[model samples]
Target: MQAAGPGSNTARPRNAAACVQVRLDDLIAQRIAARSLVLAASRKVSAAQAGVKASRFRGRGVDYVESRGYQPGDDIRSMDWRVTARSGRPHTKVFQEERERSVLLVIDHAASMRFGTRVCFKSVQAARAAALIAWSAIRGGDRVGALGFGSGVTGEVRPAGGPRGVLHCLRALADWDTLARVERESGPAPLSQALERARRLARPGSLVVLLTDGFSSDAAAEAPLARLAGHGDVRLLLMTDALELAAPPRGRYAVALGGVRRWLEFDAAAADTQWTDAFRHRRELLLQQARRLGVAHIAVDTRDDLSRCLAPLGLALATRRSYV
Candidate 1:
């Protein structure tokens, strides 16, 4: 085969997945490296007028940009008295338009996340989404942190600013996926622990984003979600499969028969109607609760484009009146 030139898409090994994990991961990661996951949460809050500078040191008072010589039609109020007195130049100072905010991501990577019938599994999708959001939050000049949650908070990346800090958050989620595990005997970590961390780490105005399949066998996710929602601007981005959203396939999908792949007796409509309705109801219920609490709620299937899905959020965030 002829070697492709620079910028050509490399053909990956085809036999493994419907889409390769790394390809999907990279694709999802690139879509929002600095703004991916936070787009949804950012939408629920306010945004700066333009691309914000990266800063971790949130000023108690808004910082002013350099005072330049007053230009035509410059606002008289912007005139800096100190500069006018010192240099005798007509100088106008511009205040930073965006206030600094922190973002916390709670990610789940249990055995269940590994089950995906589409281009990527929920765990892989969650990782990519978390990576993108962390990047986006940093770009918006917000402190970013993450916790890998399973039965509990298995890993934590202390909140900080910049790409290094974002990477710290990503590695905490990705690297920890392998290193962390919960026992079946122990069950999933009490959701309370994860919520407590979110509460303690996040101040009133910070943004908290949770990426999960909403598939915990635990009694209810509502309590933790409610508490976390109370702490800051919290958004729940439910990552789930099409099957969960769609009614079970009518007849059958291929299933393993004995030791070999063969047609097996299956009931497409066997799922209890009550169960299906309950699942749908819960997804919406979560959204309603988030809304009631002023938290942004968004649902994205694993198969969707990471960028386009976030554009609505960007527009939503663009309307924020800066705190400063």
Candidate 2:
């Protein structure tokens, strides 16, 4: 998608402050759009079945039950070596398919996320994105939870099923966004700390979705992210604004920062190259990290439609025909 720059209709609104800030009603309204999302792929089973059905799409089993004599069709990877040696017989591990999968949203409200040269701030887009995912997860019978971290404060909502769970997440998201806006000068909390907290809160086999601009993520975050991925599915949603993806036309421009207006000069030959390269490097670093961990990475631009941006997630979770 083309980056929205100066004078573009898709760029900052006339009343930028109001448009940039997230609103609870806007997040709550995502539930209607979320109805079209399919969070996980599964074959239709008997109506009487309890809990989420085992899906081949998930690839990994959950909740170990016990060991049993190995069957001809048993997956060899699940061989219970310890039990087999003691029993003097081949045995395989058995796992009970997960009842309700928990989906944890780790949202970043870093100071960088507060700036946008598009329809809204990166933080606003992140909140909307998290809300859609939260609503979709609840509709799919999964528990929804969230962790909002930025600056001096971090808010968490433990996983809960149904609408209640999603509401808690939405509230936390909105509250954190406000906090980030008010405490803009305090700088951001380390992304590593938030990831570490997420690792602790997430249950095994849960799905963890991290929404951030990646401004604060660095080498320090790799270990915690890797550990979290080892135990559950991890997806990264990298939020970006038009300005971050591409530089504006070279010229002197008036800008506002913290309610103070100032003039800045931009030159395509030097400043533009450096600006583009910096953003590219940051984006590449995040992409490389995601690849190393074997996780999904989605780039979300401020000007893009939320529904379209999330289509890949829906597809990854289920078959194409599963879209509602």
Candidate 3:
């Protein structure tokens, strides 16, 4: 799947009445369901050698607190030259370990995401997924932020703690959804651009979650995705629709393309094979990329229950291990 062209019909799925768009109140209500969700590192401890020191679960401290007299075990790299010269004593910068982890959500609202043949549009499902993740993160005492990109427009909410952070992200998601629904003239920005922006906004130890249909992404996304994954955990939530995975029952269907009515024939076996193969190729490309970067990838179909679709994510977040 690629970005929808100009004047393309943004048709709703057969069951479109269920959830065509996301509401702020619905997103906020996810907090209640998120109470049972866990987004923190697991408490289970692995065996370690008696003489070996255990590494920290999170990354090294990056926020400076104050300078103090250097201790024998202090890292030399943290030495404060100015303080050492003024006091005639070696001093080192002290840093506080961040107790709260940062989670950045990169959501895609491209035109391709606006079509679905199930419970909701891909964009709507992505918003719900983002909301659930945000609520779960906040529940775990972590900071939540979001970056929404579509139709050449980008919106960002800086990482913040508590309900304020979740609310800000929810609003951005809602606004992006509305824009994607109304704007059909311009194509969506490439996925690489959004990933690049996320790289700049993310902190070293942040967990970056990308919610996209994987249609806007291509070979161009490789660099920024790898760079983002280099310093933090990157998770891909690939949104898909049932029709995209398989051809409809053998028949001739009338469809609208670029605001023009057209007839499509899917009776031929070769056409079905081609349709399936196209989606398969896209999925395999993304999966291979995630494998190379050692990141986690989860596929969520439009018809899938959000709770069940996100079960793997909970496990992934709870452990340091990567999954595909």
Of the candidates shown, which would achieve the greatest lDDT relative to the real structure?
A: 2
- What TM-score would candidate 2 get against the native? 0.75
lDDT of each: 0.59, 0.77, 0.77
Query: Model 1 over residues 1-324: C-alpha lDDT tens digits?
Result: 011112211122244442323233453345334433344332222324323554433442355667788888777877898988999878977665445677888877655565555555666566666666667776667788887767444677778877778766766665666454333324555445666667777766677778766654233556666776555567677887655565545555465633577653336455546546766764565565566667665676666665555555566556543333
Looking at model 2, which ten-residue stretch has the lowest summed lDDT?
41-50
**TM-score of every model?**
0.64, 0.75, 0.76
Candidate 2 wrong stretches, greater than 4 Å: 1-18, 41-98, 256-262, 319-324
RMSD of 1: 9.5
lDDT of 3: 0.77
User: In candidate 1, residue 175 scores what lDDT?
Assistant: 60
lDDT of candidate 1 at residue 205, scale 0 to 100: 63
Give per-residue CA lDDT, model 2, range 201-277, as digits (tens). 99877789999888777788889999988887889999988778778798998878668999878965788888888
Ranking by TM-score: 3, 2, 1
Candidate scoring better on lDDT of 1 and 3: 3
